[model samples]
Target chain A: MNNYALSISFIDNKLLLKFSGELSLYSITTLQKQLNTQNILKIKDIQIDLEEVCFIDTATAIFINNLLIKYEKLDIKVSVNLNSKDIKDTLELVKNQKLHSDKLPSPDKESFLYSVGKYIYIYYISLLSFLNFLGNLFTTKIYYLKSIKNIRFKEIAFEINESGVKALPIISLTSFLIGLVVAYQSSYQLKIYGANIFLVDMLGISILRELAPLITAIVIAGRSGSAFTAQIGAMKITEELDAMRTMGFDPYIFLVMPRILALMLVMPILIFVADMMGVLGGMLVASLDLQITPTLFIDRFNEVVAPKHFFIGILKGPFFAFLIATIGIYRGLMVKNDTQSIGFNTTKSVVESIFAVIICDAIFSIVFTNLGI
Target chain B: MDKVIEVKDVKTVFGTRVVHDGLNLCVNRGEIYGLLGPSGCGKTTLLREIVMLQEFHGGSIKILGDELNGISHSKAQKLRREWGVLFQAGALFSSLTIAQNIALPLVEYSDLSQKMINEIVEFKINLVGLKSADANLYPSQISGGMKKKSGLARALAMDPKLLFLDEPTSGLDPISARDFDSLILKLRDLLGLTIVMVSHDLQSIYDTLDRIAIIDNKKIAFEGTLDEVASAKSEFIQTFFSDLK
Candidate 1:
């Protein structure tokens, strides 16, 4: 509620201000602004009468104290006429606050150029640290290669279940929808030219060579990549990673390798599943929309869709897996001493992995086009 | 002479584990009351029950004349604003600066202008022994002690008649804990607050709490001032209070 009343007047070179009602932070601003627009400097004396004020909070109390100080600094006579001990005690609280406190140091503000320089510096440091992490991962993998028995097979199996097998439902749903929509849309044009049977050729080639692998990789990047970041980041925050290091366990070998190996091992299988589901969807749309029988669709698919296209799609899986796992684990290790940074790094991991997958796909397109695959 | 809070035969159960059965306690107005017990003895749980954050299996908790059980939504909200709670880990929102954290309750519940809110926030910051410059830092950016102080400032923002603190001095250094104890005493006398705190710190208990209730075996083992607690026969109570010379 706007529950305060304020009035001001001048009498014999003295500015008299009277306030009433509940004087709290809710109404102090209006009173301050009104007092600000007045010609109080011209008066020789100032009087603030809070006799009718029923309640006053710390904000109003501080305001009254400031008014007394501001006018008194001008060598102007100031008097406060209030009888409430509550108000008096609040003012005294402010007074004690001023006397017994060490002001905390605030952060320094930087110029635009300085901020740019700082950003570049931070980027450089992070790049160096990422290179270090990559080097350590390579060495750890090579060292564990000689003694393959040292690998954490249990953790890798668990991760495969988490990132690969558990992802089948969502992957199937999205891939099937995409394949059906593409077949339906392409059949619209193909039917106009009496090329209804060519729907199988289009769906088989595209889904096997590009759509299945790319879609599956993108989904994994969003799911497993983000989980890797958040899990590791939480471990880092709780000092679990540090505890492992202190106990003579290398985190890269123990934690990072299991995730990387599991994802790489599962990616190709996940893409194969996506290809089957997508083709199943396209086969349904082919029979329903184009009046092509299931046998006819299967015949066209097997005769025209080359094995090289399916192999090419599967070949991209491990590379995409490597990119997603490395980026995810790298971002996780980048987390600082806060829960917020874990969230920040998790978001960065997903975006970077997805972007990298697309870029890697573009590179594959260029290489295949040149080699005439 | 007025009772600010009363827990009558409160029973709390989780599965077959009975945390509190037929436990009772009362807090008088304008007194600093401590809820003390051994670790995992349900001191924090009892405090949570009183603040209405957790529900009890049976019995009623009355705060400022309103029964918590079967209370209406609007009535619960009104009762909520009448007091403030400080959690163990400070519980400041990581997304907001310290100033914004303290200003949140006032902005949400009052018609105070932004400028006035800032003034009140500044006063509260100072009142809790926090510096004005520390206002811009997020909860994660500040020290543990500073975070506790910020939490205390936020708790006092509405000038609540009752304050609930859970282990306010647990993680603080000795100097900061002592400072917190004196701050509690000063704020209690100045604000006339009836505080209910769960504390393991012996120094804080002796320095601030006018009365204490020690929970043992899911019931109130003893309830009185520190002088009266020494005579209690419970082994847990003797172990806890015997260290005090």
Candidate 2:
């Protein structure tokens, strides 16, 4: 039932008593009995090393404090050594609490309202800070561009080509399935009006202007965004960022710039490939269901999905890429010296990048719709 | 005994907590300077400031006679190339092999060919007393002492004039700690490099340091040779030294 365990090591008359386990209310009587049985009162100097101790409660602190006072009266010195700061601070707190035990507790009613108002103020400040960050991004972009040029472009090209090009097959296949589903669904509706051939136009426009970019963004966000966050986050937690700084290397240049630029370059190409695959998927469905010739479908697609649609879709590519890389790097840099912060930032990066991509897509949709493209 | 690093009236504050207040120190060339203090006494913070990893709010730091704050980024990087740091916990890249870790600085900073870089990595590895076969092993595959050695090898890859180590002997057995200390002494003697180490290991400090700086009460509480520090009249220092013994 004893909550505390103490082992004494005698080294040249120095009594080093190693205290371990918990020291709580349940253990105090047993502890006192053990101390008395060990003839602890006979010892001149007792070095109570709490380094190995796991837990110390109020009861333990009071017991230790009383022992110290008792030993003081006996003219025997008592010294305590605690390994952890938290434990030491907690013990100090226990001592202070004992000193002020007679004081009445007063709860402030306005504390809740104060906290709410403080949070609101923080929210506003954060919003303004985000705007400032956006403004800094433009200035940072200039520095980033200059620094990007310093990076081994060949290395970046290899990384991007590996990450982006290798992903093409999966992206193409997924987008193709999306196109096929759209074609099959629209065919059912179009056949009701006896205008089934128009399914080509519907599939073509949707794949080109919306589905391709949206799907591509999501895929890249999951793949590249996560990679960016994990890579930078690992570097950060490991002091590699500090290493870079000490080496006189701008981490933004050595790490972030290449990543951001690589994503920007690769995304547009990936989107283009996705668009082609999606259209081909639509063609497969159209020929199978509508009994339409491939030539007729191509003609309709070329007529319906104009250069404007292609341009707008491709435009979203770089923006989405930028969003993913920026959010990833920003979140990665935001990570503190802890593993939990890294996980939190990585999740934030993925969520923020995806959200930003969707919001950008909405804006593109509204703009293209208004422009009559 | 030329002054390689000088800090005058430096102050660093994170929010309301003053990490360093008016802390001053001067480290000479070719001397092993040890900063011995309890946890959160700003030893690491001071080391960070020396390498320009952390900024100061007041006063100035001069490394090799160049004002730390005034140096341009590229210039600072060049300055950093002259100094090597072995961070606490080794901090080796998980993905990189020992060879790749050692080769990083040479590859990044120098125009050495792959063959030359390989030779340099081998030489550095051997200098740290690790076999060339150990080069391919990742940091996780090695023991803690080996990792520390690998970190030391990586730091020395650039042939830096100054070496900074934070808790270099931490988390090692007595023999390993002693071996690491000997390796540090060997590197310093062989290369004639100045070393600034932050540590609380009394044995290591006494065994290796030419001088010691004691950080306490948000400032440099004491700075002198080990004998002077041991013989000092200060209650805190006396208690600290006695506790270590």
Candidate 3:
């Protein structure tokens, strides 16, 4: 039902551009390219015709308003002709708000100094907030120790079941699939080199040492981590967190601590289960695809997969869980009292936790390698 | 007075349940009309339908003389500027300061100068009995009653011919509720606005409404002036009055 199209025509010294589509953020690029391809100095005037424009949003309005300012500054007489009352209303809104708005210059229009200053300031503030969050978490833990009876054991158990037990089926499936894929791909190369029996050795070491914990943490970051952010953010939006504070209860102790503790306690168990499933998957593929019997696969797997490698992988679990829970809680707590903020923060929580998990995994590998593990 | 809002044979159905059927209501200029009923009686649903935020199953809602049924995009935007809806939470933009919230509509819908916009923002803020200093505070920084006032100020920003208030006094204290009622009355007198309020506040109903429409058994069981509503012999009306007391 959205019949949108744009066309341009030249008349003497003026360019007549007609917009028929929903002139929104999606169409701004084409609009910008039209301006880019045209030689502004050769054309003295440009008229935007909005007769058939079906809709216009704030982003489009801001873009057009900024474009007009640029044309005006360049001595290009720009005008807008409209028959649609809808376009008039949108432009009217943009015009009224233009004075107080942050004149959106497309990214290329932004000054280098402004970008640098803005990003630096943003990062600095984010770092400070993170430190503050850690400090609050530490003090809350101390407070929980003093009032152990006040701690929400019931909620912690509920969270453990939700984040740990509920995640079992999906985690097992992903781990098995990854292990099968890894074995299938690597066994072919090993077979060509007449090292077919080495399939179990390679799969076992890789899955237990790196893949299992890393993949599980990544999955949990997207699922349970985002859930934490959404739950906490919704609680914040409904003012339940505020209500707790005013009622002489620390939200950190009652709300945040339980979630963080549950995730931290559950991650090792999840990773261990993931390791078993993954190795089993490798054994299945090795026997079926590589002609290695199940007994031979097990013998090689047991001989090559060292306890030190398994220990090193599982040790990263608590750390990954801590980062995921901490990042999630931080993002959720940072959420402003609005739907947009909740959505934005939940997305940011998932992305940042996954990134953090991978980075921490890399650091763990490097430290373990240096320690001769 | 010309009717600003006229709803005829309006019907709303959800799955197997019927929310409204053959419901008709007419509101006149410079008058406050109240809609009252038990919970889930579609009072808010009717308000949403009237505001054009929702579509009815069957009805003709003629707003300010323009029929809302099958209204085009351009016509809808035009109609939107002529009326404002105040949600129960005030629904102020959280990121914007109070003045920015009030100025949003004017900025979006008018060609007024920056100074003029600021002046109008100040005027609206003061009209709602807020200090000009409050103009710089965010919605979160304000109390519930103040948020309602800010919401009202924003609702009045575009100088809408019709104003819709949804549960305006639900979370307010008695003094604040009374103050809100007086403010609504004062605004009606000052601006000649046609107000459509959905409320359960008996004080608000008695203080602000000139006419009341009560819903019962899925239709308007009673409709009349406040005094008429108070003395109506309908069993539902009697219990409403008694239960509220």
Candidate 4:
């Protein structure tokens, strides 16, 4: 197949060649011949229309970079019209890299130290700002309470069912497989000690304390967190937030509260489902590899994993939900009235939500460990 | 004339930038007041302050004789019901159909039955000149002018006594802009509603406004009827008029 197509048109004494498809090593010779036939040497202005081009790898980018350099030397103005912003950004980055290849270097000793120091300073400031925000959140409990009072319970419940219930099957399947893997991995080592029953303790504790919460948080971060960000960010960029305020609606109460409450109520249920699936996954592995009956596996699971473990797992649910929802809304609200800001805040919301969940989980782990629970 | 909105010595700053420095203006009931200025002249900021969306550094703002600061959150929200704002980009929810978009406020604030809500939505859709069939289509599936009309329909759903429009004719063709202007004029005449608009479109301002407030030099440059503004002879006003000549 001819992987590339090139169309050349002369308009207003300008050579406008629209290039579509790929520009590869094989196609480069054909492109060169076509350009030569057009008397490119005499062309004053050459416009490369990349509007239909799909992919351009490093080699093709380099070839184009060289062509641009050669055209500049021949006193021909070269312009490119690209379809996708990603492609345009890649080309710009490639051009910059080519132009500044010699000047670029790994950071020196002092510069590295300075960079580390700067990062440290930024991290410290961000942490302080987060703490301050949390402090404000607590101090203004009345504001939160008032906002909470305005939440539409029916609407929030519907949204919870939509976001949470619909995601159950996949979450359950994945966690079940995770549990099975953990059980299978533990059985081999436990068999060596003739203490295979300890596999239950290991699998149960790990899933309840760490794996379930972490997996659920990650899932929700990608699922509900991104949705919250996109919804709020879009609203922000479109001035719907402003419209809500203008229409005698408190945006925080109408928008943020509903989502927050929905997530808060739904997360615990999701976590419980995840834990059950994880145990079932362990049961599957136990039944298959260790020749243990399902009933025996359940009894073992019950014996080793205490009620506190379940409580601890459940306790982390609301905190994780709060972290995800709060960060999503906060980052979304930070969006400026621009498309770039909206995208930036959407990505920021997902990353920040996941990061906050993990950090909060670690704190909970530390506190639980210290309390000897 | 009864003042619907009054801003006295209002100042709004964004970090280090002073967007509105001691700005003051007034809009009378049943009058269409246009805030006219170049881009980034704090017209949007002024609108936000009037709507109680932005906090003023130092000033007293009274909406329908209620002190802006003293008004409770619910009271402010109730006051907001008095005005409908059509944002620059229409701000329609992409996921919602035109009918649902129009019905949002009514569903949220009113205790109307679904049949009543549907009727109201249909009435609004027709009021903005959109067909009943157009109600099922999402915002992204429609044209820009249609989206603006849908937004206006939603804004009008609350049957507001006051209306605020920000760049209502922006990004629209001349024909669409004219149609929108005519619609605004018709709404005002029919409903006897007060309108506060921020726009740089001179034609829209002249065609619809009872009086125009020109913002320049961090304050109101002039506030009067269009003819009076035209005769002011200030350099800014003169240049502005000459540009359209």
User: What does DockQ give for each predicted structure?
Assistant: 0.02, 0.49, 0.02, 0.71
lDDT string, candidate 4, A104-191, tens digits: 6876666888889989998897678667756655544457666655548876887798668987988898888889888988899888
Query: Listing candidates in order, what is each one's chain A TM-score?
Result: 0.86, 0.70, 0.71, 0.65
**Residues B1-245, model 1: lDDT tens digits:** 98999999999998799999999889999999999887898998898778765689998899999998998856776777778778777767665699988997787668999999999999999999999999999887999899889888988988989998989999999999999999999999899998999998988998899999988889998899988876767777787776543
lDDT of 1 by residue, A209-234 (tens): 99999999999999999999998887
Clashing pairs in 3: A93-B108
RMSD of each: 21.5, 9.5, 22.9, 11.0
Lowest summed-lDDT stretch of 10 residues in model 2 chain A? A143-152
| Fnat of all models, as shown | 0.00, 0.63, 0.00, 0.97
Candidates 2 and 3 compared by TM-score, better number = 2
Candidate 2 per-residue lDDT, tens place, B109-145, comes to 8899999999999999999889999999998899988
Candidate 1 stretches with Cα past 4 Å from truth are A1-12, A18-22, A49-55, A81-86, A99-111, B1-245
Question: Residue B129 of candidate 1: its Cα lDDT?
Answer: 98
Deviation (Å) of B150 in candidate 1: 30
DockQ of 4: 0.71
For A208-245, candidate 2 gives per-residue lDDT tens digits of 88899999999889888888888888888888787667
Runs of candidate 4 with Cα error greater than 4 angstroms are: A1-149
